[model samples]
Target chain A: MSRQTPLNAAHRKLGARMVDFAGWDMPVQYTSVIAEHEAVRTAAGLFDVSHMGEIEFHGPGALAAVNGLLTNDLSRCADGQALYAGLLNDEGGFVDDVVAYRFSAERILVCVNASNREKDFAWMTARARGCTPVDRSDEFAQLALQGPKAAAILQRLTPVQLSGVGTYRFTEGAVAGVDCIIARTGYTGEDGFELYCAPVRAEALWNALLAAGAANGLKPAGLGARDSLRTEMKYALYGNDIDDAHTPLEAGLGWIVKLDKQDFVGKAALERQKAAGVPRRLVGFELTGAGIARHGYPVLKDGQRVGEVTSGTLGPSVKKAIGIGYVPAAHSAEGSTFDVEIRGRPVAARVVKTPFWKRG
Target chain B: MGNYPGSLKYTKDHEWARAEGSRYVIGITDHAQAELGEVVFVDLPEVGKQVTAGKPFGAAESTKAASDLFAPVTGKVVKANEALKADPSALNSDPYGAGWLVELEPTDGDTSHLMDADSYVKLLG
Candidate 1:
């Protein structure tokens, strides 16, 4: 049995095709994946991301404790700001990638991937000493309102002055009479706001946003559209792209790792690996042939297995089959040619620069 | 749920076949397209290729996944919807008419195992 989100009833009533995602009963699509994906790219799309987990830390040492456990330098973030970071094991491999929101000097909230919630909480609780670590997953419901018209649509309901939020910034205010933390963040590589509110008020917020965005062409998107939208931007999904066995360095997320910063988990291993040089690196590739490259498909170089696809999709915006996977650092260069084996047939492919779909 | 024409024979795999003399026009049901979301690509079997009943002859890939297209009757594929190669969205918009997959010259014209529209609608429930 899977857990249900606060908005589960609403999704079912809208005729969404439900699927078991990370042990949560989630909608894969309410209408069509392509239409929903295109809506987020062009106009706006509302997404119930309440399945994502929230872990909070509060105390005098919350900032330092959080900085010690994650890869990014949290000290650089001011109050009411959020930064993308990764939680890594001692071996530099990902425990889970998260967004740490700094609400105050002593209060921090980290949004984690749903599948890794329990494990991430346990890991953080043991390492983040001198601070209170609370698993507040059930307390909050998240909604991602994304696309070009997102701000215009959200502004219709909230008087928060969304433009002042800025990218990676958040503010607390009432949206549709419901208190929420409106953060200017999204996974779609589009301008958007992620609204976090109490679970009890999820449906009300969802309903209000939908009614507000209806005139602006807002569609109720699902996990299927989410996957395609994120893939077009080359954003790594937790279980598929990054996992306990793969490090941030190998996943092209080295920019998030602050080696010069003070001691942190995985610091020693990353430093040692940096000194020795990385053997493999992740690269984005596009299939030149007919078949779509799917996850777990082998990447071949001269009929020999060189790597395997981590995440893939027929990008709705780009209209091309694109994917990200790890290969030898030598073969990770842009324009490098390789073959992605689709059902035993090697389809020709070439590594390309990421962000396959750039907003015009 | 889409209207399953009473004139067509249906397969449990969601394919439908309409007989026209010795030839059968085959396409996936509206329910199939609805379940598959939007079709982005339709990998059709080449003309002159033999297809066995209940066996997959091609694939219809949507953004979410790729589902194999099964043949409802044994036949030699006489024609494939070439327009679908450029625009597969027709499968979602008009599954029964313009979205027809192939025209087959039946080697054994038997559709005894297939169901009618009423039976297909019952299966959907």
Candidate 2:
């Protein structure tokens, strides 16, 4: 049986179409993917992201233990700051991409993908030097309120000053009479906040947010819009875009990998790979001809198969068919031509600058 | 459960064929469109192309994935929907009407294997 989130019934009440996503019975769309995608781009959209896993480290050694596992330099972050980082295996490939929130030297929380919850906890616990990793996935239900109007809608319900919480910064406060960890972060490439609250208070918080934001065109979005929104921003989805086999350098995520930092799990292997140079790199492309490119579709150069697409979709905001794939460094340049084998036909495609949709 | 027009014949693959004189109007069912989410592109077979029963003739691309469109009866394409190229979301908004995929001139006119609305609804359950 698939696991259900705290707001599963609420989604059903909103007439959402449910699907099994990474073993969780989740809402894929409440109306249409395009509508939800546009809603987030123009107004605001709410999402039940409760399935995301949370791991906690508490002790005087928490900061060092958590920082040692991540590729990003977490020690640079001050209290109440959150940073995106990669948890790589010993071979320099990703275990999972994660967001670490530094509440203090004694308390840190890492938010991980739902599918990697059990595996990530075990990996961290085994390698942790001084502190035991605690799996807190089921303790909190997460909700994301995202878009241009997100601040206005969220400010109405929370006592915490929304403007004071800058991007990637968080503060613990009460929202709509419920205690929550209000983090100014999101995956949709929008100005928003992720509210993490107790599971028992999820329904009330969800209803309150919906009621407060209803006038501002806040719609209850689902996983469908979330996927497309992130795709437009060139954000990598675990398993689809980044995985255990592809290192951060090849995935166009070198910015997050601080190789100069103290010894991490994959430091040695990454050092060697960096010296050898990255052979293949991930690139963004748009179809020049008919047909939408999809994941697992063959990418061809001069009619010969060279690579495969990792994640693709017809971008709603951009109004074009766009995709990301891994290609040899020689072919991973801007304006390089390629063919995405759609069905049995080769449709023309061209490499382009990333983040298909840019905020104006 | 979704809207399954009673007058049309349905296939287990979720396609609907409406008999129109010697040609059959083809379109995906409402249930199929909803399950596929928003249809971003519909790849229909060109006019004069031959399509065989139980075979893929085109595809419907959604924001999430691509689903192949299978032919319900062996036929030759007489006319393919041109409107879908400009606004594919018509497939999600009006799957049975404006979203009609193609008009096929059947070689044998055989649709004995296809199910009616009742049977198709039962299959969905």
Candidate 3:
């Protein structure tokens, strides 16, 4: 069954086109993908990200319990700060990606994708060991206020002194007469904030922010806009770009893996793989022929099957067809030559640099 | 509602064809362009190529999705819009005007295999 976000009613009222995304009925677009994508790029865009999972871990054992749960060192995360980390299994394969925020030394909240919520909660609960893990996904909603003008728009509705919130930093503040957690982070490669608050108040806060950002061209953006924005940056989606079968090293996310850190799930295998270096690596490419490369299209290096296109699109930002795929490490360098087998034809494509486009 | 120029013949696949004398200019419809949303890259059909009715001549991809541009009529491609090589968004800007994909010489003058603008618009629903 498809789930609905708390802001579903609000999205409907705005005439958003909705679709089933990973079992959740989410808005894919409001006005249009290009318009919404530009709204976030040029100005500010509000997103109903309430479908994302938010879980709270409290009590004394929270710190130790979460440390073992995630690959990143939670000890490095101070109070009122956030860290992007991955949850891995014993094989060093990623189970899910999340933003871990420390409310205090004894409390932490991890926000994950909606599809991974139940599985993540079950995994955490089975090994609760000493802490109390609460599934707050059903109790809270998340909204991403993204773009260059997002900070100014959100500052008007909240008294949180937004200037002080650095990147990846979060604060407990009040907006729309309700307490909220504002995190200075977003999927879009822009300056923005992700606000977490009570589920019941989602519609009210969404509407209030829309009213405040009206003058700034803030449209209530949706998943369609979000996908394009992130794709422009070559940001990987969970299932499309990375999954449990693939290790972080192969997914081009080796930067997130800290081999020297304390042992976590999948640590040993990752350490060995890191020492030997990855055999296959993920890289981005641009289509050169008369076809739009899509997911599952076989990737070829000199007429040989080397990999397949994982995620691809004609990016709205750069106005070019860009996609990511795994290839042999030797062919992973920028400007390498490769052929994308689109529709059973070897379309000439070059291994361009990842993030086919970047913000100026 | 999207723009449906009264002068152009449209295909159910969202491609619009306008016959200019013996040559025909073809491209995606404004409704199709708006549906695709912010076309960035347009895969233009090669000139002098043989195309069949309902066969995908090429594609125009936007952030939202990539849509195949099917040939409205069976013809031999005479020309392709080269401007879209650097600026494919001309399709989104003017799908019927400067955004014309391929100019073809139709195999037949009788409208045998394509739908009209009104019929195509009704097919969208």
DockQ of each: 0.62, 0.84, 0.49
Identify the candidate with maximal DockQ. Answer: 2
RMSD of 2: 1.3
Off by over 4 Å in 3: A285-293, A314-320, A344-359, B3-10, B17-25, B106-113
Name the top lDDT candidate: 2
Model 3 chain B lowest lDDT segment of ten = B108-117
Cα deviation in Å at residue A245, candidate 2? Answer: 0.4
Candidate 1 lDDT by residue in tens digits, A1-360 = 999999999999999999999999999999889899999999999999999999999999999899998899989889999989989999999999999999986999999999999999999998886796999999999999999999999998998998799999999999999999999999999999999999999999999999999999999999999999999999999989999988899999999999888788988988888999998888999999887877898999999998999988789999898898988898999999999997667999999998899977
RMSD of 1: 2.1
lDDT of 2 by residue, A1-360 (tens): 999999999999999989999899999999988899899999999999999999999999999999899999989999999999999999999999999999998999999999999999999999988899899999999999999999999999988999999999999999999999999999999899999999999999999999999999999999999999999999999998899999999999999999888889988888899999988888999999998888889999898999889999999999899999998889999999899999989999999998999987
CAPRI class assigned to model 1: medium
Highest TM-score among the candidates is held by which one? 2
Model 2 DockQ reads 0.84
The fraction of reference interface contacts (C-alpha pairs within 8 A across chains A and B) present in each candidate is 0.56, 0.84, 0.72
Write down the lDDT of every candidate, Cα atoms only.
0.92, 0.93, 0.84
As for candidate 2, its interface RMSD to one decimal place is 0.8
Better of 1 and 3 by TM-score: 1
Each model: TM-score of chain B?
Answer: 0.97, 0.97, 0.89
Model 2 ranges off by over 4 Å: none
lDDT of 3 at A323: 82
**Collision pairs in model 3:** A92-A266
By DockQ rank, best first, the candidates go 2, 1, 3
